[model samples]
Target: MRLTMLTFGLFAGPAFAQPGPPAEGPDEIVVTGQKRDGTLQDADASITVLDAEAIDQARLRDFRQLDDLVPNVQFNEAGQLSNVFITIRGVESNPFIVNRAAVYIDGIPFRELTNAVLSQVESIEVLRGPQGTLYGANSESGLIVIRTRAPSRDAEGEVRVTGSLFSGTGGAGIEAYYSTPLVSDTLAASLAVKYGREATWMRNRAAGVTEPGEIEERFVHGRLRWTPSDRTTLNATAYLLDINAPGLFDNDFFPQDRTLYDQLYGALNGGRPSGRYGYFHDAPKRTDETEYVLGLSVAHEVGSGTVDAAVSYRRDRSDSLGLDFDFTSLPTAAGRDDNDQRVTNAELRYASAQQQPLSFLAGVAYFRDDKDNQKSTFVGPGDLDSYVAAPVQTRSIESLSGFGSLRWRPAFVRDVTLSAGLRYDHTRQRAVQREGQLDLGGGSILYYTDARLASTDDAWLPRFSITWEPTDDATFFGTIARGYIPGGFNLAATQENITDPDVLRYRSETMWSYEIGFRVRSADGRFRASGAVFQIDSNNWQEIRVLTDETGRPVSSDFIGSSASIRSRGFEVEASWRAVPGFDLSASFGYADATYLYLFNGIEDLAGNRVKLVPEYDANLSARYQHRSGVFARAAMNFVGAMALDERSYAVQPATTMIDLQLGYENERFTARLFVDNLTNVRRFSGLGFDNLAFGTDGTVYGALEAPRIVGAEVEMRF
Candidate 1:
């Protein structure tokens, strides 16, 4: 069967694309749920597809390790990559950078949902729950559709590159991608780029330092499409990102010093970086991103069905420059600038035309976000950072939305089928603030912010699904959802006593999800399995209160909302088997028994905090082999199972597994790839921390996760 679908598409490319030939059959699949065109066992809910040959054989530069290989998904990123936690089934994450997952690149919807990134990806449709109607707002706990690689309608495009090596003072980098087509059927375009430099396997103590803090990333994208007939279409896209990293493996912001992190992990029990710890330094950060997109699509018919339309526009800009202290003896540093955003969105829809078994959808959307900022904090040089400059903040956002959906196949449940949707959003917010004091020849004065303390909010989201197929490869599903996240104004300052309590009185978090899934394909195609069970019900639960002082630094706090109650139940299993044709075996297992049933008022020290960087159980196993002239070989293993580091609750960070190897070769255009990650050069620590040694408060930090086991390769050419 086409070499078993190209050895199951070589588990999605990290080097050379595989999984070729499938214009039909393999049980037809391509879905965004009720957005239309179903098949993934008739789409009902719960979806996970990586593809792109598993992002070039898992060289994955921030695929967030595919979050435990998918299931109750959770991927947290801090420091340089900033806050990127795309949680699912956990009901939504609320740490910082207000992004509770809601990203899209294909149907356009990414005005900064934490700028989800995964270079040149061609497929990555996560979709867990509460995707209002067709997906709107932060989506509460689901939706991550990032589909790139467009601009080839009648012919070619290809390019590839890879590099990596990390064990101690991290360093190694590279990645690239390309595509083309100009008038073969209208217009086309594509692009991808990446760069890296690594160092900082941590051990910085007084000039006994070594090369510390290093990492850099760059991204670019372009797209254009147009078709006049055979149904209509138009598309325009743009993207850019630039970042300078000096710390990317955040060990959850150190300084809760546990004997200085057990004397720096017993002075390197898992050692490397032999330069006797010399040259360690801190305080560095720089990030910038720019994006703009334009889109249009149309389909016409009418008589029986087929009448679809879509429209969109977007503009975004994000900026950051660092060292305010992840520590290097906190010399208080800052050179920040944010010219936030200006966005626009438009969507018009109509579905149900063609050969109808009944289909429908509608839409109207508009959005605007604006911001400007400039800040400063310095010491020792440049005239005290130019006398402490200022212009702190400015913000604005305007939104209006409407959405709809429907699908039917009612005829006495001929194997049943039904889908539903709804979405409504109305938001208006404004904030302008500035405050930085210290004068009388000490220079530094800025205070401005108060325009009747602006704010506004409104949202209504709902989505439903049900799909049952007695046969067709087997399928069963059910879903109920409600999600949304957006609430602002809090530059820190929490009041507990004497007058002062208007940090824009923020609060708004809602979630309700219930899911069930099972999709099987066996009959004779070897094997493919999917199973899921989920439960999410949350209220308020946006908690963060760290106002330390007395050497704990940070004395600004105001990020509250907690009638606190969170519950997430999960179970997921994934499978793939061919075992004979060219050899293949894929497996995944997940189990998340989350907690925090409720907590309010009495704080009770957060009564049992077992929900941070969750890891109840996780596993992934792979075996691959393919040859016919397009050589291939694979062996993989990744497992993580213990974590939970903070929230007034004790500590834990254990459970490690890493064994990866991949080799590839392709033809018909040109392709090559190689891989190896922690292939046993093991020296683990992927986050989960604390060490508050009794008031003498030791303070130590280490964040350089799995790099010492290095390897890299990538090459591509197509046209």
Candidate 2:
């Protein structure tokens, strides 16, 4: 047993508790990550804040449990619950297009991350880099803002329960929430609910089906608030989600020497006989999903300046069933996929006032999306030994934007400050495609068509900043930015290789960023520090591949037609210390290189490599303790470094460390907790798929594992 990596450390392990002040002195942390709302050391970018008691003391239920505790966030989403892939600082994009990092709730904008939900979240702000002058076109790898939970002026309620111990892959959960005040101080309301289920340890050696990967979920929420005077306010929200999982090539495969439970019963009937071998399957994979959301917000304070508005509507539906494509148990092949989506949004803003040397902010935005997608495959099942493969698509998108920002304060230096921002965006798109193959009684061997392909794109984003505050706990900052991503239409397969529908439309991705930072607070704030250095450069950059047909079967895949260049550089450090009085300590460290400059795809050149799941170093350490007869304890550790999931494979995903422990008892209305997550049982491997990486006898190596070892217990009540 041996494994140790720990790239950068600040006294080793733990994080998520560093906003400072308390233990009877100092205090700060009231942030919005700059859409105006201040105080995270007066915000100058490079932020990360997770409140709500640090998300219930790290029970962080989403976003991959907030990996590395927010130090250059990274992901690959093993056994995906809905196609997840995100990277920040290493800015990733194209996991079948769209999403270059952007998520917001309470300010709309969502298109993935399974529709972003974290129960009744009350705070979460992560704005790492390239926020494109106040968000535009996916913000080019940066931004995740959430704020929920508001509505309580008198009554309140809560309830919770959780259990897991992994005895035959265990899991369980339950939740509830409530709030009130309906016209007391001028209205308020809230409600929430949740449920969960899990169990799956992978066992299905040719239909034996022991645990076969399982998951289930459900959630619901609602809110409303109004305050007709004292400068007006209004808000409303709604949500719903349901999910079921197990797919992403249903796990259990490991070659390079048996020992995945003895190669799953020796590949269930041992090797070749028309491709029916290993991890032993018989075609069955699943997924089903549903989502919906609605929102509205308004604010006013006209005299001293402030006005805001927002609106949203969304819907999503998905289904993917049994896709053993060719993991071999000889059903020959199988597939089914579907998607439907809709969205609408709007925003408006204005801000000014703050005495003295000029200040301003202005904004406008609108967006719309509609989509439908389908994919199907089946081979040999009826009438003349049937085979059918279908592909369908329909899409539309529209967007418009306007933005502004300006600020300056000068009376001969005296604590300098300057800022600038600009944004202009326009987009329009429409695409419809159909590619087919069928033979149910011998008919229509193949066909392809793409009609109504239209496109339009425009952009101009910019930002600049400088700040220096020589006192009140010090600060220094600098920044420069520009970012964008837009371009689409690609869905063609069947030995596809540029069958020119105008080259299948793909282009648009750009970035440029630079930063410098510093922050400090220790004049009785019990010590706090921050640091940053950054650089980013990108161009074009998009990816997708899979094509075959010539005695190796499997035909069709697309997306790639010139343009690739990338670069990333990073440095970050964060700290907190309270020492004594109720005890607390925190730490963070990060580093990134994220290579690739002039990457190739016309037969692999891969310029300088690196940059597939993005990781070059990340660290976190945490410690906390409290007593006064309430009792508490916590310990944490995190690390990730080593990633490459393909771009001309070498299959990597090592460098891991995760340790967590928690114990509790609280008062102000009872609570209890006990947790242990991946404490040590690390079997490693968290996603990799090459869609049969050029099938050379090793085809079908599909893998996903890691999430074994959980022991949880929770209980709560409040009123």
TM-score of candidate 1 relative to the true fold: 0.33
How high is the lDDT of residue 611 in model 1? 66
Give the Å error, residue 400, model 2. 17
| Per-residue lDDT of candidate 1, residues 1-719 (tens digit) | 00000000010111111233444446354554345545456678778777677665554555555674676676654433444556565543534445577766566655344423355566777887778666677767778765555556655545554454443434454545555667776665555555555554434442322324554555555555555554445555555555554432232244333354445443332232223222223334444455445555545545554455555555555555443332333333334445555555555556553136667767677766676766554542222124355555677778788888777778877888787778888888777665443221113222334333467788888777788889878888888888866666665431222225443355666778888888888766578788888888777666555444465434332345445667778878888888788778888877777666765423364645666667777778878787878898888887877766445435555777888887988777877777776688655444334332112234443332333465666666665
lDDT of each: 0.56, 0.66
Error of 1 at 255 (Å): 24
Candidate 2 local distance difference test against the native: 0.66
For 1-719, candidate 2 gives per-residue lDDT tens digits of 00000000010000011233443445777666467645777667778777888877776765566655778777555453545557887776535566688876656777455523255576778888878677788878788776666777788988887777653457777878898998888887777777777654444455533336566777777777777776767777776777777632422333322343234434433542211122555555666677777777677778777777777788878776555544445455555667888888887878776464778878888899898877665553322113244666788888898988888888899887888889888989887776555321112133555556788999999888888889878788888888878777665532244457545777877788888988888888877888788999888777665454444333544555436778899887878788988778888888888888877765677888887777788788988897978888888898877777666556666788888888998899988978887788665555544444123234333555555567878888888
Clashes of each: 42, 7
RMSD to native, candidate 2: 22.7
